[model samples]
Target: MSNIKIFSGSSHQDLSQKVAEHLGLELGKVVTKKFSNKETCVEIGESVRGEDVYIIQSGCGEINDNLMELLIMISACKIASASRVTAVIPCFPYARQDKKDKKSASRAPISAKLVANMLSVSGADHIITMDLHASQIQGFFDIPVDNLYAEPAVLQWIKEHVPDWKASIIVSPDAGGTERVTSITDCLNVEFALIHKVRKKANEIDRMVLVGDVKDRVAILIDDMADTCGTICHAADKLISAGANKVYAILTHGIFSGPAISRINNACFEAIVVTNSIPQEKNVKQSTKIQVIDISMFLAEAIRRTHNGESVSYLFNHVPL
Candidate 1:
């Protein structure tokens, strides 16, 4: 691990430190600051020439600045002749804009692809991220991209916390997440359900209908992320109205942007489970319904395996508990 150097940006320093500690190493020193004009400046404190360099920066608070800092750091490492540079972004930025749905009418740009291009152009040799909003976003990058899953850790949490797990039903808030919910239910040998939503306009959900039985059973909603929490809260209300004994939610990234915390606090869910893939301290502190699970150890293991040229496919199914 001597040749492996890990540096962190300002977005999520706590998570980076934990990941470094899990690998039995200290974080590499780097000076990062914003100028008077709010421009990012990065200076590597140590020589990274001929060494594997991993920059830990999640696209969360101050998203633009964090992203710019990561790109600049990658360029600096490459300029210094580092052997390789990997952007270890726990929560990728602009992941939701993975497609150009409306071309002529709105000129929708695939921002996810744009970010991928920026990273590549900025001297990133590899990418590491977890539970991307859209899995196909991996295809946007020409270089090697490791898309890790947070399901193993989430499943482990469910197994230990949820009583009578066999009686609970895994639910997908929308048709798009059916595959993700299926994966979790299959692992637990449990039944699963799906919620079909009808939208009147952009970001305005008209109604939601459940496709399976949740009556008298615990309903666990699973998704990749929750930004505004509007859909999640509405789904939880529907589950409760449908006579579900209890409602819970598990998502990889707890963006909790805008009014997400307020909505979640007033929602019917007993607990809103999420991984610390994004900095959620404020969200957790503000809401009694929020529960955060650390995924640093899992990420650390993936980094170790990747650095050692070992296969990380097994990590997809097993949590490193």
Candidate 2:
């Protein structure tokens, strides 16, 4: 562990600090600033020669700027003769754009793949990220990639925080999340439900229909990420209308962009449980119903395992606590 160096980008300094502390190390010195022309400048204060380096950066807070900073940091480490450089991205940027837009006459770009290419070209030897919007994005990277899951943490949170966990039903807010819901339900041996959402346009939901029985049961909605949160809020309302006793929304990344805070404050969800994959201090303070679950320990353990050439699959099934 002595040769393991961890540095943080400006996206989420608190989370990066926590991860470093968990590994019994201090964050490596790195200075990042803007020039007169508004271009990004990064300077690594210490040597990283022959060391295993990890750069912690999330896909939030002036996303494009954060991403460029991460790329620069990785390149800096590589150029300094670091043995290996891994990007520990808690929330991957441009993940939702995993595929092209076929409906548009002018096809939309698959920005997710482009990000992967950028990281690799920037000299990133590996990538560690959580719950990518689409798993297939792994194929876009030529380097070794690890896509960690938040399921173990989410399950532990439900058991400890939510009452009647055994009686609760896992739910998917949209058809795409059915697989995630079923995996949780299988683990808890609980019933599962699905909500089919009709989308009118981006950030707008037309209608939501509950598929399975949620009557008189606590409904827990599981999703990988939430942007404006229209889907989760609408799904919660549909569950309540279908006679669900209570509703909770659990997510890996709570982007909470646009009108998300207002929606959660006015929605039917009893509580919105999310990981600190993306910083939530502002969002949590803005809404009483929003709660954050720390995942720094998991990321730290993953970093340790990678540095030691140990298996990280244990975290996929077991809680870090």
Best by TM-score: 2
Per-residue CA lDDT of candidate 1, range 1-321, in tens? 779899999899999999999999999999998889988889999999999999999999989888999999999999999999999999999998988675345688889999999999999999989998899999999999999999898888899999978899999999999889999998999999999998776567999998999999999999999988888899999899888999999999998988899899888888999999898888888999999989898789889998999998878888875
lDDT (C-alpha, whole model) for all candidates: 0.92, 0.93
Model 2 per-residue lDDT tens digits across residues 1-321: 778899999999999999989999999999999999979999999999999999999999899999999999999999999999999999999999888666765678889999999999999999999999999999999999998999999999999998899999999988888888899999999999989988777788888788999999999999999999988988888989899999999999999999899989999888999999999999989999989989999999999899999999999988776
After TM-score superposition, the amount by which residue 68's alpha carbon in candidate 2 deviates from its true location, in angstroms, is: 0.5
Model 1 residue 276 CA deviation in Å: 0.5
Residue-pair clash count for candidate 2: 0
Q: Using alpha carbons, what is the TM-score of model 1? A: 0.97
- Highest-scoring model, lDDT: 2
lDDT of 2 at 178: 85
